[model samples]
Target: MLDISVSAKLKDLVPDFRAGVICYHHIVIADLPQIIAERLPLFYENIRLSLEDHPVSAVEGVKEWRGIFKKAGTDPSRYRPSQEALLRRIGKEGRLHTIHSAVDLNNFFSVQYSIPLGIYDLGHLEEPIRITVGTQEDQYEGLNGRIMNMENKMISADRSGAFGSPIVDSRRTCVTEQTTDALQIVYTRPSTPAEESRRMIKKIAGMFTQIHGGENEWKIIE
Candidate 1:
């Protein structure tokens, strides 16, 4: 386990904000598990149909994140939160291309719960992680390979600096097939009940271990 804390700055902005962190050790990473390969398309189509009659902005989950981003001084329409992005993709494309098992699983749960989920290789992180507002001076190479301007956005930072956010994650901590240890962060909506977050995190841990063969422990940080 690691020391993870929500900064006072963030707490003051979104009083009920909470996050669920799942830590995995010695987990095997696969390109694609048979079960996920078969199940992902179904999940994507289900979400697409569920949102077919409704715009992504009309979704309760997406609305919650839009509010959060506004409070953080971010323009939700410009840099949409990860959940809204995923939901919009499903609405437009009806399916997502497979990455690896870990990423695919994260995306599945993220869409199912309408929350932004981030997974990182533990080898790249430092202890005493803090979730706080980003600064103009803070920038890092995102998973997309471009320098991310994290200014005024909510972000997760270790001693090495910002590595993940509800919007995007830095490439420095991205998980690969060779990774053995990882951390999955659930950026829950402020109004989401604690019990619901717990159930989701537990489900994520159970599913990951069941598919990838590993042990995991999880906690909620507020």
Candidate 2:
């Protein structure tokens, strides 16, 4: 079972912060679609087509995320939430580097729902994935190899220190082609609700079931 905990420190800062999590095991990530790096044009083309039908309206959670970022002593305009960042790119560039199916699905959901989502390889994580406030020493290397400091912000950490946040994630728990056991998290803000979060999970789950033709062996994340 995955042990998920939230600290009062984080609750005090963003009391409405909630996450809806789902776990999927025994995925055949290697057998999924290829062309990860070469699919940027395709993704952009799709986004462009959809932008006409579904104009890139500001996601409802964006305002709350901006406030949360400000409360955390971070610049909301500079360090945008993951979903906001993706939406900006879609509205402007509409391009994303190709990642495998799992990561790609997360991106799809991010842009679709305007929520910050991350999939972490459970195989790489230690138990007690605690959600807590960041300290001065809680810096971790992002997947892009840029070192980010997490002072006065909410962070998700395991035994190895912080790895994920509402803004950016670390490379240590990144999902890859070899990832079979994974935990997907939809980070919610005050502007988000449980119903909306569940819809996001359901959409991703349905896509996985359709594409991979496999079942998710989910366990309780108590």
Best by lDDT: 1
Global fold similarity of model 1 (TM-score): 0.96
User: Mind giving the per-residue lDDT tens digits that candidate 1 earns over 7-91?
Assistant: 9998988888899999999999887767559888887898899887888999888899899899888999999999889888888
Error of 2 at 55 (Å): 10
- Candidate 1 — which pairs collide? none
Cα error, residue 197 of model 1, in Å, equals: 1.8
Q: List clash counts for every candidate, in order.
A: 0, 1
What shift in Å separates residue 121 of candidate 2 from its native position after superposition? Answer: 0.8
lDDT of candidate 2 over 1-222, digit per residue (tens): 478777777777766767767677777674345444356467667866776666544446677677777766678777778877777677677676556777777887776666788788999999888878789999898876899898876678999899998788999899888877888777755564566656656767767655545555332221
Model 2 scores a C-alpha lDDT of 0.73
Angstrom error of the Cα, residue 39, model 1: value is 2.0
TM-score of model 2 relative to the true fold?
0.82
